[model samples]
Target chain A: MSTLLAFLLSNHLKSRFVIGYTLILLLVSSALFIFTDNPQKGLLGGVNLVLLFVPLVVSLYTGISLYHGEDFTRVLLTQSLSRNQVYWSSTGSLQLSLQAALLVGLGIPLLLFAPGMPAVALLAGASILSLIFSGLSSLIAFRVNDKVKGIASLFLMWLAFTLVFDGLILLFIQLMSDYPIEAAVIFINLLNPVDMCRIVLMQVLDAAALMGLTGALLTEYMGNLFAILSVLLALLIWLIVPMELSRRSFLNKDF
Target chain B: MLHVDSLTKKFGRLEVLNSIQLEFQKGTVTGILGPNGSGKTTLIKCLLGLCHFEKGNIALNAISIKSEKEYKSYFGYMPQIGRYPENMSIGDLFELLVSLRNQPENELDLELWELFKLENIKSQRLGKLSGGTVQKVSAALAYLFKPEVIVLDEPTAGLDPLATEIMKEKIRKESSGKITLITSHILNDLDELCSHIVFLNNHKIAFSKSMKELKASRQGLTLNQIVAQLLQGEA
Candidate 1:
């Protein structure tokens, strides 16, 4: 498995798309730090960028690369290795490559300018989100064999998680303003990895106070440690469920 | 020995192969002949475990395919169109496959590798190779591991005349002491290379017989004429 993983990672590293992605992240984060006077302000921008950009790029890139490598995957399946090894190694290589890009692209700037718990939180949140989306992409790639349909579905998923879900939650809260629904809203928010990541970053950045009622309710209901732990748990679930589902589908799929 | 018993497969309500039963002993080269969409590929895919079958089982050397993946080590396959990673150089691809197999270097079969002169183009990326060259690569990799059962899908479809002759000679050389299964539209090639031939039509085997039996049954008729007569009879 490691041999396959190393080979896939080498192939991925040589691609122009990955290099361009890494360079874009490096440039954007570096510029954010250099131009802003306050590191916290830059961290705030970084959070939004990570939340908006990371999932979209990771999901699309992983999906497309998997499709492109479909033929090679067939070749691998014929070898002595188990299907689990092939699926995991290919997905692992994609996840690790993207995460490394995130770390280098965002890690350097955060450490150089804003070295604190908030910076660490930002990095962790971004890395976990990248992994979560990679898993989703793998699931899509395995489940939908057609390349165009798979990509379309991936874009829809990113839009739902990042944008549409938040809007629906806001509408739900607005419509049920008379009732005590703080717990329900919080539970619903937990379902969206993007929102949970944002909450974690905001809490650590001391910007939770800016969240108004939601922020106050979050702090009052669940302590800082509990909130972070629960969010991390949610993120972990997001990572495992999709990956496991994809693995099963891949094992049984006809090449 | 390779044994396939009552194998049945379907793809979304369309039956591709129905009750396929076959057996091959060592040193026997069987040609799988069929028209387009006649389940030739599906049958081969079933044998390789690439396509899941609805019923029946396949056993190689008395080991069932459903038991564990260890049985797959005995087989080597060459896909009709070899699609490798575009950026991967031939050397790296060979190294990867060699390491995965973990066979001793001295025991490796370098006959096809040296004959194809792949060493000279070791650094070339797979995407840059011509179709015939890619076919050569697939052919070499299939024989590199010295598998007990070898499957070649359209082995000489895109090759130049010289390469085609070279492949046929290699097949002849390796056919002894190994079970070789080939699927091709070129009857002349099969006539020259295969000891036995299996014909598939309408999702089932039409006939399977040795070359001598087929020739004796239809005196003075070439394989092409024999197969054409069979198809006409069915029509």
Candidate 2:
């Protein structure tokens, strides 16, 4: 299993795109984190970037490799490994390697910048983000035969999250400006992985900070403890939903 | 050593393989003869359990393909095209496989190293190699494991005449001792390497017989002539 993971990493690492991938994300995340007034808010921007950019980029890589690697897949499958071992081992390997790279590029630097940040909270947030995006991208990439189409779908989905989602949120807030409803805000926040990540991270910094915001809609109505825990629970759902759906498709999938 | 029974596969409304049953004897080459999109590739994929089918039972060495992992241990495969870590040197790529499989030196697939003339490019990366070279590397990797059952898809498609002869010899030798399945358009390859032929048409087994039986049935006709006789009407 470790070798399989290493094989995947080594193969992708060869593309000459991986260095640029790491550097560009590192520079952008760091710049935004440093430039913003609140590093916490900068983290929000980073979440938007990571969630949108990372899934698409990773999906493209996996899509092309899976289609082109048909020969290799044949050789490996013909060997004495059960479908269960093949499925879990390869997925396990691919997931951990990408997660490791994510840790190095994003997690390590963030921790160094914020010495006061608790390790457990930061790790939990990062793992959930990585799990949700990685599983979702891999499954989509595998389902499609055309690499370009799969990649396009990933980018478009990311675009919806990065751009259209914000626009929709603005329109909603504009309509509700007079009302300032607490329930609406909490529910809207719950629907998005990126938004859920921010609320959880910010609450970790201080539950009071989130409650003090304009309406404190979430912290005020749901109460600080419930809202914080709810965000964590939402993160769990993000990981579970994609992984389960992908797993089901993958098990019976014709590849 | 391999048996496929009533294997039927459909993708959407297109039925790829329809209730095809065939058994391969040990120590004989089974050539899957078919044209493009005639369910040749789909049958191979389903047999290997790489693709799901609506109906079928595949067994390798008497173990059900659906439930057993041991089939993997029994074979090696050379795809029509090979793609690997283009950045890693040949040695490193093979070594990674060795380590992953926990293969001892005895299990190493060095038989084709000399054939591939890989000594000069042992340190070279896969992406930098030419197409023919890439094909050679893929062939070497597939046969290196010395598996009891081997599958080669158009194994000689990109090789020079000399490399082609060497590959034919390797396939003939492997099939004589174990089980070998190959799919190819080249009738000459079957004449040179295969002991039997399994012809597929319209997602069904059109004809399956040993080379001797086929020759007896169509007395004085060549393997290509026999195949042409069977396939021309379907086409």
Candidate 3:
């Protein structure tokens, strides 16, 4: 597993694009944390970037890496390792490296500028989201054989999760405005990993009111502890389901 | 020994391998010969447990290949193209494979590395290497573990004459107590290296016979001529 991690890092470390992106993240994080008047607000400001950029970047980067790593994966498969071992090692490496990059690029700034529980919670939430999206991207890339199509689908997945899904939910709630749908809204929110992260952070940062009545009602129904645990569980499912499915498909696949 | 019993495979509606049956015993080198789209690669993939077959079974040393992964440790595979991550240096690639194998570095067979002169370009990225260089790397890696079962798909496609001769010599040496399966369009190499030949055509095994019997069956014709006649008969 460490060799696999080393392999991935060796390849990733050579890419100028990854280095540039991480540098940009560092600059953005430092600026966001340093410019805010209140540490809590500064952490919140960073959360917005984590919510929007981390998933997108991680997904895109992971998708491309998986595609490029196809040959490397085949080499490993022919070795003494099993398919399960290879699959998990690849995913584990991606998770660790991407999360490390996020933590180093952003976490240090958060710690230096805003040292508190909210900073810790936000970093954890962002790291989890990174893991979930990297898994999701790997699964998507493996399912599609064509590189161009695989990358396009990855972007589409992120767009759907971040933008289209929420839009549809809003439309649904407006359509069902006459009905009592707080439970349904909470259920829907848990289904999307991004929303799960948002809700979990809201619990930690006491920012649930921004979600309007649905958020307030969800906070009341599940309470802070339940919300955090459920979101963590949801994120775990997001990370595992796609990775397991990808492993099964990869094992059965030809070439 | 390796046994393939009535193995069948299909890609959607197109059947790639149809009830294929073959066997490889110890100390024998079998050359898998086929035309374009004859399912030679598909057959090899099935044996390696990379492609799922619809019917029949493949066993190595009496162990079934179905959902069996540890069995892979017994074999070494050199792919046709030998593509790898573009940015990985040759030295790092070797280290990665050794690490993945979980075997001690001292256990690796460094013969091919020395013979192929790979150490000279150890620091070169895989993407920067030529096709022949990549084939050398693949060959070196395949034989690094000194596995019991070795499969080479067009292993000499991009290799120069010196490298090709070195690879052929290595395969011949390893065939003493191992099962070596090779697929190559170069009939001369097949005739010179293979002790047995398995001819595949139209998704089925046309014939599988020892080189002695195949040579005896056709009086004056070369192995290439015999194979052409066999393929024409199939059509």
Candidate 4:
């Protein structure tokens, strides 16, 4: 635990990118709360910002963090610690720090402007996404040996999640317009963390009017508690699966 | 003491270490010498359990290192290149190590810290230090824990003369009642500090000899000359 804290604290102090990202998050969240009139509008604005930015930043940050910490990782290996300790501490600390950043970046603003169920739900969702992506980044970093390729793959994955996957989903829906594909669409949305998050946020805000066809269908079919809980459960799976993979890969890796 | 038996490691089709067998006894400094890409680092990594090996076993203090981690507590390693967390100041790095080792504040060793004037630079971040300074930091950290086994890879590669002398003195002092394994291309440093020599060539132990044995065979020849002659014979 101390090892994890020290590692994360060291990263927070040394990496300019981390410092800059923290500052940007603070500023953006603050501005959104101050400028917007409707609390729900501000909440939606923050949600959109997080949905767009959190995964990208988490992936890139986790990728570079794992790559840059190679020497430190070796250092830990030589120490009086177990491989499990070293791997988990490094990953756990990075995940915790990123989650903390999300809390401060979005949690603070939401609490200040729109303190309610929406804020709690959004915060939980944002934290889940942060963990999922950071875990994803670490898995990618460990699996890929080359740094350039690793980073490129990470961004590509992010692209697939945020933009390409959804676009492809829409395309699929359009192509199969003659048939009833709502059930299939609901299942497909569960596969993507970003989509799962979007659906959860829509349900929480009771903004099904804006949920499009798939979101409305999911809401109508599953209702709020079932839809949100299942999505939340899916997000947790997203977090745990990649984390387990990266841990195993890291343990087997040669420093 | 350390023992490695029939150790083998490969990267794809290229074998780096091939069924290597070796041992180091307590109270001796064994220097590992080899040509580039000869798996010196790989061997060290295997010993520290940082890398996986395809075959063979390693034992420390007569206990198998297989699926066991507590054995590594006996080792203190300094890599060929020193790389700390970039943003961490020297003090913070030390603090991190202290906490990781779970040692209380009072038991920490400040010998190398004083000898290297590390206190003066405690405020400096690792990223800002020169190569020599980083080497000094690595040396200090490796020696800090006072472990039973020490592995230093190119320990003095980038040090200035004074720092190198200090390092040599430290290695010599620590050589008593402990096993010290070092790897370096600087033959003179090996000559000055090592009691035993293990030469690796073509993924195998070409020869392993005590410094006294080699010296006795070729009277009045320095280690440098002896090794040069041996390499010439191989060529």
Candidate 5:
């Protein structure tokens, strides 16, 4: 497992795209800090851009590149390990390494800008978001088995969650113009990881913006801890269910 | 020892291997001969557990393939056409396989590596290697781990005379107390290397006989004539 991790992480670090992405994050976060009216907006924008996009893009790329060399898959089968072990180790190596990049790439800027939240809670929230997407994108890549398709799925999901979800939310707001629909919008937002990104970062960035129903519920419910824990649970389910499906498919479906 | 007992595999509607039963003895090489689309490659895939064998059990050394991974531990495979990660250098690829195999005690044979003068190309990616060189790498990797059983599909598919000789010698020398199964469209190579010939025709074994018996059955006839007679009789 350690060797697999080392093998994967070393490769990830070697990639030009990953290095470019990290540099882009460093520049954007640094520039945002310099220009914004306050640290809150800078942090929110940083989390939105760096955190969300990086995990989705990096994990998808990792899956495609990892299996591109299938001659090694045959070599692995000739060893004393089980097929399940082979798939798990390979997939786990990819997931863990990509997640590590997500951490170093995004976490550095995030901490530099927003230093209020307990490091543990911030980590928990980021992990929830990371786990959800990485597991899903990994599963999609394995099933699709083509670079174009793997990348396309990530873009499509990004479209649905980040853009389309907000469009629908606005339509609902227009429909319920007479009533205060902020509460309902909050609940609807939970369905999208983008919204969780907003709510999770809300405390660090403009605690006032979180006066909406979801934020109030989170801030008021069992405090931010409970809310973060709930999101983490939701993301954990995302990880568990899809990973189980992917593993079963990998084990039985002929590669 | 390797046993493929009544192994049946199908690809959609095509029944590739139908009740294929065979046993391989250690310290000898068995040649699998068949015309195109005669389930020779399918049998090799089934043996590697690369394809699902629907109606048969494979055993290695008395342990069922399902019960343990001893079967794979004994196998070193050279695919007919190997597609490697083009981005990786040959040395890196070799090291990667060694690491993936958990650094097995048996090292990969580099006789052909030196014979083919691949030392210069060690840092070159797999994409840069020529067809014959690729064949050498595939063959070298198959014998490299020095596994107890080796499977080569079209072992000498693309090679010059000198390289082919080097490969054949490696196959013969490495088969000591081990089994080497090779499938080839070319009969001459098999005639030179195989101790046992397992001929496939119409989804079944046309003949599984020792070299001595095959020679005896030929009655001074050439291998081609004897094989033609055997296959014609089967059809």
Candidate 6:
């Protein structure tokens, strides 16, 4: 399994898309730090960038790569390895490669400029989000065999998670504005990894003002440790469920 | 021996393979002959576990395929259309497969590799290789592991005369004590290479007979003529 992982990682890292992604992240993060007067403000700017871009980039990249790697997967399936091993190693290698890119491209600037827990939280959130999207994209790739359809579905998924989800939450809150639905809003937010990650970073930054209604309520009600732990739990679920589902589909799939 | 018992597979409501049953013994080359979309590729895929069957099981040497994946270690499968990672060089690809197999250098079969002169183009990216060259690569990889059971699907579809002859000679030499399965539309090649023939039509085996038996039954007819007569009779 490790051998397969190493082999796949080497192949992926050599691709132009991954290299270009790393360079773009490095350039953007460095420019954000160089231009902003306050590192905290730059960190906030970084948060928005990471939140908006990480899922989109990771999902599209992982999905397209999975489609492109179908031939390699077929070859591997004929080897002396179980389908489970191939599925995990391929997805695991993709997730690790993207995470490495995130760490290097964004980690260097954040550590150099905003070297604190909040910066660490931002990096952690981004890494988790990368993993979450990788799993989701793997599921999409395996579930939908047609490349164009799979990719279209991936785009729709990213849109739903990152943008449409939040809008729906806002609508739900407005409809129930009469009651004290703070706890319910927080519960609903837990379903979306993006929202959960944003809240986690906001909690770590102690920026209640920027955290919208659910984040502010979470800050007011729960202790810092409890809030972070709970959000981490939600993110962990988001991480495992998609990956497990995809793995199952891959095992039974006729390639 | 490789045994397939009552195998059935379907894509949605369309059944591709139904109740496939066959046993391949050592020292025998079985040619799988069928029209396009007659589940020839699907049968090979099922044997390699590349396709999931709804019922029945396959066993190698009395060990169930589902029991473990170790059975696959003894299989060398050459796909009909070889597809590989585009950016990977031929040398790196060979290195990866070699490392995965982890067999000793002395035991490896590099006959196809040397015959095809793949070493000369070791640095060429797989995506840049022509279809015939890719077929050469696939053939070499299948035999590199020196597997006991060899499955070649359309092995000579795009090969030039020289390469095709080389592949045929290699298959003839290596098939001495192995279970060889080859699927091809070219009956002449199958006539030259196969010891037994299994004809599939409409998702089931129409007939399976040894070369001697088939020849004895159809006195003066070649395999092509026999198949044509059979198709005409069915029509």
> What is model 2's DockQ versus the real complex?
0.65
Q: Estimate each model's TM-score.
A: 0.95, 0.88, 0.90, 0.94, 0.80, 0.95
lDDT by residue (B91-185, candidate 1, tens digit) is 99999999988799988888888989999999998878999999999999999889899999999999999889999999999999899999999
Error of 2 at B101 (Å): 3.5
Off by over 4 Å in 4: A3-7, A13-15, B67-69, B102-109, B215-235
- For B8-29, candidate 5 gives per-residue lDDT tens digits of 8877788888899899999889
When candidate 1 is compared with the true two-chain complex, its DockQ is 0.68
In model 1, which runs have C-alpha deviations exceeding 4 angstroms? A209-213
Per-prediction DockQ comes to 0.68, 0.65, 0.58, 0.65, 0.41, 0.67
Model 3: TM-score, first chain: 0.93
Which of candidates 3 and 5 is the stronger one according to lDDT?
A: 3
Model 4: which residue pairs collide?
A: A14-B87
Report the C-alpha lDDT of model 6 over B138-181, residue by residue, as the tens digit. 99999999888999989999999999999999999999889999
| lDDT (0 to 1) per candidate | 0.90, 0.72, 0.85, 0.86, 0.71, 0.90
What tens digits encode model 3's per-residue C-alpha lDDT throughout B87-112?
88999888878876767888888999
lDDT of 6 by residue, A104-146 (tens): 9999999998898989989988999999999999999999999
Error of 2 at A233 (Å): 1.1
Q: Chain B TM-score of all predictions, in order?
A: 0.98, 0.94, 0.97, 0.95, 0.92, 0.97
Positional deviation of A204 in candidate 6, in angstroms? 1.8
Candidate achieving higher TM-score, 1 or 3: 1
Give the alpha carbon lDDT tens digit for every residue of A9-65 in model 2: 676655565656667667876787688887676665655556566665555555555
Cα lDDT tens digits for candidate 4, B1-235 = 6889999999889899999999899999999887777788898899988899999999998777764566876778888887787887899888878777766666665778899999999999888999999999998888787878899999989999999999999999989988999998889999999999998888999888999997998999998888788778877
Q: Deviation in angstroms for A175 in model 6?
A: 2.5
State the lDDT of candidate 2 residue by residue for B134-214, as single tens digits.
788878877877877788888999999999988888777666667888998888888878888898887888888888898
Error of 1 at B129 (Å): 2.7
Q: For candidate 3, write residues A115-234 as lDDT tens digits.
A: 888889888888888988988888888889899999999999999989998999999999999998889998998889998888778768888887576568777898877877877888
Model 5 off-target regions past 4 Å?
A34-37, A50-52, A111-128, A144-155, A165-191, A207-225, B10-16, B33-38, B83-110, B117-135, B158-161, B186-188, B199-235
lDDT of 2 at A178: 93
